[model samples]
Target: MQVLAAGGDLAQLTASGLFHGASYGALGAGFALILGVTTRFHFAYSLTYTFTAYAAYSLTAEAGLPFWPAALLGVLAGTVLGVLLELLVYRRVAARSGGDGMMPVFVASLGVGVAGIALLQLVWGSQSQPYYGPSIEPLRAFGASFVNLDVYQAATSVVLVLGLAAALRYTGLGRAVRATRGNPGLAAAQGIDVRTVYLVCFAAGSFIAGVCALWYGLQYTVDPAMGTRPGIYAIVVAFLAGTSASPLRVLLVGLGVGLAEAWSGLWLSLQWTQTTVFVLLVGYLVIRAAGPLLPRRLVGKGA
Candidate 1:
């Protein structure tokens, strides 16, 4: 409270909160596409998708390109890398398992993560590179100040989340995904191409994650290990939301967590700030894990 009241660090804290929300939203979207519903090669694709975005950002920054062009190239390269990973590595592993068990997929994702990090290190030389671009002009409105870039990034995340939710709810593609996730065999019986749906979902998730990578690069320095932290946080957020289908819920959770994290860091130390997220994750997990263990009559007899 004293630190926040001091006011000197408020702006930086606000900016960090916005960026953290965006990162969490992006990561949540990526993992949700796999664990929450899609639950297959989608996870593997996300691994590749995140890795490709990191690699592209590193390449562009190292090459001295402008931000917009670099972002464009990064997204394009990410899409291509996503496609290749899906078709080559994921397809082969899925074929071997005949899409029956999850262990093979999990192992394959680990392999992909290792390979992706190694490739990034080889190309980017394992050093953090400065991400240079136009400084965000801050504006004050209604007694609240915000960095323009943070506002823009948060707005972009909201738009993407809404667009994605709408597409999944109203579009034919969305129906196919729901069907596949609900029951692949039944979806196939109804003439839906399950494999195609899986591929498209993976691609879409990766694309969103690529956009997130660009925003992150704009806010922070690009590094080979950048995705690891965000990726873990995203997983926690997704689970905390209880596999929520609402993108709004996901966005809100991200933003709320971001605010909490920022507030904690301001009041405490930076190290405790990181620990707070894990603490929240563990607390949520315990509550969830205990839900089924409680007596049913005591759990919800009146409700």
Candidate 2:
């Protein structure tokens, strides 16, 4: 508390944390969708976002394309690639492995992530590049300030989360996903087209990734490994947020994480940012794990 009070700029740090949290929340929800429907935790998902950001950047900065066109192309490329991964790699592996295919799928995603980085290096030369886009001035209020880009990014995340929540709750496609998630065999028997659900979910998740990547690129330089850090935090947040289908919880948790990370810099070294966040993850996992165990133990004692 003292450190934070004495810190160079508390307001700026808080604002930074909020923006970072919003990004993490969106990414976490995206991962949660894939996890809930497909039962596969894709470690390589970050690569898709990073790659799309780079692709969009290259299209606009190098190929001389308009911003929206380049962004559209990049988003399409990323979504298509995500669907292809599901159809080509994960689907085949799942078919072969049957009930316990998650491990195999995870391994394949890891491989994909590595391959993505290598390909990025091969094409983009592993150098960080600036994002080309329209400039916006900073917005300030009550001694706290942020750029318009930050506001856009944060707003985009919140809107996407709400939109996803609405789609999942009120749409036919959402019903198919919920049905498929509940029991694939039953859903298939009911002619829910489970495979289609998987494909759509994966593509949707990837589309979110691409959108996030565009904003991320706008805020920071694009590089091959840019997604790794945020990816880890987002995945952890998804797990911490539990099985609730609401994105609002994820958004709150993401903000908490961002606050913790930003405030840690006041008292801890810069290198401890991730470590601090992971500690929170570890603590949450332990507490959640204990929840079920404690109930079972109480039941046993009562019996």
Worst 10 residues of 1 by lDDT: 41-50
Clashes of each: 0, 0
Model 1 C-alpha lDDT versus the unseen true structure = 0.69
What would the TM-score be for candidate 2 when compared with the true structure? 0.92
Candidate 2: regions farther than 4 A off:
1-8, 292-303
Candidate 2 to native Cα RMSD, angstroms: 3.3
For candidate 1, the TM-score is: 0.84
Model 2: number of backbone collisions: 0
Q: Give per-model CA RMSD.
A: 3.5, 3.3
lDDT of 2 by residue, 157-206 (tens): 98988888888889999878888878889999999998899999889888
